[model samples]
Target chain A: MRLLYFAWVREKTGISSEEIDLPAHIETVGDLLRWQKTRGEEFAAAFEKDRVIRAAIDQTHARHDAAIAGAREIAFFPPVTGG
Target chain B: MIRIQEGDFDLSAEIEALKDSRTDIGAIVTFTGTVRDRGSDKVIESMTLEHYPGMTEKELARIEQEAHARWPLQASLIIHRVGKLLPGDNIVLVATASAHRHAAFEAAAFLMDYLKTDAPFWKFEEGPDGAGWVDARETDGAAKARWSAKSSSKEEPAST
Candidate 1:
């Protein structure tokens, strides 16, 4: 799956976007976040404070428990206040 | 009917393009959004807008189509400027033409309301204080919800 980060999210994570191999167990968004946390220090720091992070699956707003099967892209960002 | 460009556009040229010899165009409604000096009273020095290339165009087109379905429109245009912009620079333009003033006004307003909320553009403003990325506002979400809910209700026939 492809993972995308924006705004302060990219700053914290230290990457804009990356293609990652998802584990079979990472079937939900929550599972994906948990899996990402184990990747490295940056991932741990980025995901450690989930209060400010928001996720969207395939461009539409998504929740943590949303299914992630066959998702081509998942984007993480801070709460958007763009006009 | 929808354009996302980095170059500035002449409003007259756009309006002329939508006009013809036919006297049907009785009204032309337009909304121009400009960068304010401040976002929440922060003195913004400059701002840079970023967007997903393909997805941005797709989303704008969809919003335009939705407005057309709701109102009887003769012509419609949505223009958005991306990249670095300063205060007073035009950020967006939404114009609607119709035979009646009501349709033109309603469609133009509808376009802007949705564009503000639904468009996938990110703005990073650099101010005297510091640089910060603008977040999505709850008011914008409310604006989008109004149209979406109206669209959904219209989908179902009114119960007699």
Candidate 2:
């Protein structure tokens, strides 16, 4: 699966997007977010303010409680501020 | 049409292209968002708009489709520019055309309201005092909320 980060989340994570073998235990975005917290210092900092962060599964806005099964891409970012 | 691009656009040309000899379209409403030199009360040097490529297109298409579904529109266009840009550059353009003034105006407003809170684009402002990403405003979410009330009452058969 490919995980993408944008805006401040991208700046903090130090990378835009990456493909990884998602852990089976991470069935939902909430679970994936919880596991990402343990990745390292950068991941820790990026996930530090987790609640304000939003996610999109396969390009659609998804709730943290949404399942991530068979998802090709998951993008995490702050709430959108475009016009 | 939905376009997410890195290049600046010509509004007149876009208006002309969207017209496409459609005699049925009596009204056209467009909203162009630009990078003002000031944000958060600070003078901005530059601004960067970041977005997901495929996802951005998908979202814009969804928004455009929603507008068309809600209103009987002849045409609609969304042109959003991504990547680094200087102050005063055009950031996004949304144009909608319809047979009636009310539909054109309301549909454009609806598109803009959704774009503010739902679109994946994020804004980062760089200025003399330092730089920071623009935070989403509660007011924007509030603006988007009204559409739901509208759909439940008037524009009923909604699909995202």
Best candidate according to lDDT: 2
lDDT of 2: 0.86
Off by over 4 Å in 2: B149-160
In candidate 1, which residue ranges exceed 4 Å CA deviation?
A: A48-56, A59-64, A79-83, B20-22, B151-160
Docking quality category of candidate 1 according to DockQ thresholds? acceptable
Compose the digit string of candidate 2's lDDT tens values, residues B5-67.
Answer: 889999999999999977878999999999999886899999888887887888888888888
lDDT of 1 by residue, A1-83 (tens): 78998776787799989998887887887788787788799888888866556676777656777898878989876654434
lDDT of 1 at A45: 85
- List DockQ, one per candidate, in order: 0.28, 0.51
Q: How far in Å is the alpha carbon of B115 misplaced in model 1?
A: 2.0
User: TM-score (chain B) for model 2?
Assistant: 0.91
TM-score of the A chain in model 1: 0.91
Evaluate model 1: give its TM-score: 0.84
Q: Can you give the lDDT of residue B134 in candidate 1? A: 83
TM-score of chain B of each: 0.90, 0.91
